[model samples]
Target: MTGVRWILMPLLTSAACVAQAGWIDEAELELRFDDNLPRGQLKRDIKSDMAVAIAAEGGRGYQLTENGRLTLTMTLSATGYRQYSGLDHVDAGVGLAYRHKFGLGPLAPEARASVSATRLEYRDDGRDGWLYSAQLGIGKRITERLGLTATYEFERRKSDDVADRLLPTVAADVYDLTSRNFTLGGDYTLSSDYVLSAAYTLRDGDIVSTTLRNLPIFLASSAIAEDRVFGRNRYAYKMKATTRGASLGVSRVINDHSSLTLGYEYIDSRAEGGIDYQANIVRAIYLHQF
Candidate 1:
């Protein structure tokens, strides 16, 4: 929080310099239930947890030209889990974005690009590092109450420990991976105060899975057990995987400054040389605009 505040102070101090400005300053509270919190593919020993998160962000946008604008934002968030202590984490990030509107057809088309950097701190005192992401998106407003968007994103995540390798096994690096995501989404206004949104995300990347040493693994000669597993570390092997996901959400506008949202998400992961699993999640969020 201190690091994020230092970055935010400069932006807040300079906010008065911009003219004809539009700004966003909001706080978000979310409650989520995860049937499978660990992203584990195996059916056995699956853990469930409840999580609560609080986040705040403030940003300002300045019109650069008739159709172009630049925006900058800083955000801080922390999440705590009821059962999974290892999943607790805090996040602080800054984002810079640019958008341009094209007045071509009846519906204006918009193009967007953004870059962000976030610091992640874990409660377990391991697997902590920064994540960097870049996104490019195109969107069109089809009607007064409907919009569609397609986006592509690239992200890189690093862990504090070394990555696991096949030979001369080192088990420290299970949290490190790079991912590319393609997403298509749409939002529609159902009424004066209600909205519906849905999206499908396809992610291809390297994933990690940790499981116990079993009989099938001994026959295949493919398993590598970590030294710390038998003693302290509960998870042993790190297996790579791919994931696909989808989400649906409905939001109710309580007022211009506040809203409530309910959402559902599904994820299917296929692990290489490991187990495969599916996950379902339900979440509720409240947003307050300042």
Candidate 2:
């Protein structure tokens, strides 16, 4: 969160400040079960786990134009894992977003651009990092009941330098990562209080796979490190991979300020040397807006 926070103030000061004088707050609690938590390339190393996360955010909005507004938000979250305490962590972040619409009706096309930076502290020190990301999105209403959106994002993770390298040829910073992603999604209102949504995402990036020493994977990996979290004799390998994922969800509005969601997601990732893995996840979430 080094530079993004400062940029938000300058944008707000240039705006007309027509928005009302109250902070917007949002809270969420989520429980998730993942069939492949470690992203292991081998069946023997695959691990499953359950996790819970809670998050809260607050922000203020400023009107920049007749059809555009900017929001500055601060967020905090904590997550715990049932099977792997090494993945438990806390994070805090700041974000800024600007949104604009083409016209004044429900069917008007809308666009949003946002940037954020977060500091994530993990139980495993090697996994700690500063995550920075930027995203641009556009949305249009296909009908009164259906809407579609597309988004593109780029992100980077910067972490501590590793002192102990498992292999002389392997890179030292195993946790440093970068990725680009594109997503397409659609949502349909089933009723006044219920909605269904589905999305597909394609990502190209660096992935860390934890498993036993596999010679073929070594040829495809860029980094290597000892991963003691899952147990002894396991290692972490960093490799370039392409991932595709799909998710489906349904949301139910509880009242004016609260809602609940149930979701399922599946992901498949393939590395350069034909090393691959798959994951399935299910989630339930409760959210409130204030």
Candidate 3:
């Protein structure tokens, strides 16, 4: 009995120490400004309309163990349209995440899983929709300053048209779509205040459109020809799209728990049977910790 108590006392003390070191808590707020103000292929002269958006997000984190953490985030955003002439719309989203770390000798690996729900409402059409997504990822810490991550994501969107007149008399038109994406990316930390990142993404989905119209023969024929040739119609279109993008940025650490980042991203996307689109975006982000 004496020998057993001696062993058990030290073991219990060690367990208590580990438990005390296991838990952590953190919170953060991020604000971003984006101006999709048109240029080049997105030019207002050609597209004739542009959207400018400002978004803000807040998150809270809880650590379950020394190597595992969970986070919850919420976002609210709005976009103003130019040339299209419509009231600004509000968008909101919530996300939950989990991350864990493991290691093998000199190599360290991290795994992450997340789920999110988003809602968007438009004032002009009084149309609203919901989207849900799940993602899984694994990453390796190549070095103290560099790491790589690979991810798979699946998303589904459900939308109902607010204009009942737009539905066909013979059949109801309810539109829904599902999209899946695979992505790989790498990140490098240049210094305590700067970082660089790049990513490539592939996406596959089907988009459905419905149109209700009464027109003469010539107009109808023209519309059909345009849809067939230009790939615009009231039907379901299956598509595979690929996007290649890179971002270069400098981050200024405001304090122990805050940062401000300015970055530029260039993206090029091509679809199987549709016109290619290219975009360049400049963004400013501010982060706060609590």
Candidate 4:
């Protein structure tokens, strides 16, 4: 009887230990490399840029009910860009994500929202711009490794000097723009370490500009001749454009805390009632998790 009691006590202790162990939380520090290889009309006139970004994020699970759980995450990123013409810029931003899961049947619904702000400075021209964006998304998981997500986003941009400063003649041509975008996407997770995804997006926006210095001599003279010249000769112009695009990508988890992704994107834009413009982009991203 004494030997049996000893064996039973050990078995009970092991069970208690197992019951106390729960899922572990995750935290990581990520460093990312973004290479924007440009193709199309802008390729010959503009140089491509490279950016390095770093982020730190953590996630923890909370019990919502007997069979439901929520995961909350917050992240901050700093990105710096270098252009081929020796131009450089830096931007910093923050974001938050929340995911909830309910153990009902085979599908789980999730929602997410994020916002960020960026400041861009041109090293050669001493010019800068501010850009801000917010996005919200809702999605459902079809399986542990597959899902569909739909999102809406709004973005606004303002710039100080986008055109050549030396050519103040065209400086008035520099402008600011605001855009609103809607997108739908799906993700297919092949495994714990690999995923493939695609998305279609539509963007509509308007560009606004004010006079920088003065109108060209010919236009100025014409205005003067017409007796419509003001002291400053200021003018405003508005342009509207629509863009549609698709992206395809694959991501691989290199290790417990690292990932690499490659993607291709195509975009077609047309000025309101104008000609169409096409752009192609190839990008490679490396992320490090700590």
Candidate 5:
């Protein structure tokens, strides 16, 4: 966390060098509820939580000689989760983008890249880790009210405990892995005060399955002696999986600074060790932007 602070200070200081820098341009506060907090595949393993988050972002752009602008933005967010507080974290990100306008009104293409870091603190302290991600995306506006975007993302997460060492029969079950994701999204404004959004995502990566309710069969398959080493509820296996999901949301704008969104998401994941499962999530978000 200290290192991140040091990095952000210099970026904030450098904003003064740009003419169009809005040092503190926009801020947002959000409240959200998730029916499946850990993205659990099995219904029996699902847990629910509510989160409150606050974020602030600022940007600066330089006008190009042609019809484009180069921009840099910095964003910071802090969030707290309750019901199951172990998944609480803070995130910070910085992005750089280029936008080209075609002289035709309301038509623009943009390309962007960003890097972010997250630190998770858990009450149990077993699943805590630092997660880092990088993303690249491109978007184009087809009309004044509609836009489309495609993005590719990569992430790496490293946890503190070694699961293999804790359970000898498990095959290197450490909760550290790399993942890749590709997403296509679209948004349409139905009116000045309402917007509808949808997205589809495909992700391939490694995941840890912690809540195996059928402990005896799972243990026998892994060639491990039945011991209480994993306790009643703990992560037991690491496997490669592919997850595909989609989301739909409708947002109603209350004013310039406030809005409400209702969303639903569905995901199906297939894992290597017969841990395939599906999950559905419904959430509501209340956001205030300034």
Candidate 6:
């Protein structure tokens, strides 16, 4: 938590120095279904599940200059999983961001940078963690109806280190993870009230996989633990992996301050020692801004 404080203290101080004050608030509810909730590598280990999450955030933005703005946000969220109750969690986070426009006009290129820290508490103690992230992005409005964005992000997660009694030497903090990823996204206005969105992402990092006991994964794992979320006999292993994914979505504006979105995402991950997995997710989200 000390590291998280060092990153956020400066931003909090800047908020007191700001002369401009404008509040931004938003709330969101999401329902999702995952065909591979466990990130399982074997068909026998795959566990499908559905979840619901709700979140709210409020922020203040300061126009530091004609083309630069700084914003700070605080957020709270909770999620409930239908089958994997251990994955249910509550999260609280704070974010600070800055954006600058290179020139005036709707077509001007913009650059953004942000940092955030979140604390997540799970029903299962082993999954409890702190998540930290930093990102840099660029965006441009190519036309009145089209916008594009690209971003690179670095993330770190910290979690409990509960060692198995039999494998005391094995690392047990499977949720303590680190990753770097790049994303490209675009949005096109289809009508006055509808938007079409798409995104592609490439990620290289550590991933946790749960499956029946196997020698290949057991040998490659940096961390190992019994994961009751899937089944009593299932075990979780942490391994280095690379993932590529894409998403497609459509959103309908309900009014000036609300919208509903339906989306689908597919991800393929390749881990060490010839292990691989794929996941398909369907989601519906509703958001309102105040």
TM-score of each: 0.82, 0.91, 0.63, 0.60, 0.74, 0.90
For residues 56-96, what per-residue lDDT tens digits would candidate 5 score against the true structure?
A: 67777888747777777776665666544444455556666
- Cα-based lDDT for every prediction: 0.73, 0.85, 0.55, 0.53, 0.66, 0.86
lDDT of 1 at 73: 92
Model 6 TM-score on a 0 to 1 scale:
0.90
- Give the TM-score (vs. native) of candidate 1: 0.82
Better of 1 and 6 by lDDT: 6
Among all windows of 10 consecutive residues in model 3, the one with the lowest summed lDDT is 221-230
Q: What would the per-residue lDDT of candidate 6 be over residues 222-288, giving only the tens digit for each residue?
A: 8888888777788889999999999999999999999999999999999878989999999999998
Steric overlap count per candidate: 0, 0, 0, 2, 1, 0
Which segments of candidate 3 are over 4 A away from where they belong?
A: 1-45, 48-54, 59-66, 81-87, 103-107, 162-175, 206-240
Model 1 misplaced regions, further than 4 Å: 1-24, 104-106, 163-167, 214-233, 236-239
Give the 10-residue window scoring lowest on summed lDDT in candidate 2: 11-20
- Candidate 5 Cα outliers beyond 4 Å, as residue runs: 1-23, 39-43, 62-70, 96-104, 121-124, 160-164, 169-173, 213-232
- Please write out the lDDT profile of model 2 over residues 87-195, one tens digit for every residue: 8777889999999999999999999999999998887888988999999999999899999999999999998657487667678677889999999999999999999
Rank by lDDT, descending? 6, 2, 1, 5, 3, 4
After superposing candidate 2, which stretches have Cα over 4 Å from the reference?
A: 1-24
How many clashes would you count in candidate 5? Answer: 1
> Quick one: ranking by TM-score, best first?
2, 6, 1, 5, 3, 4
Distance (Å) between predicted and true CA of 111, model 4?
A: 1.9
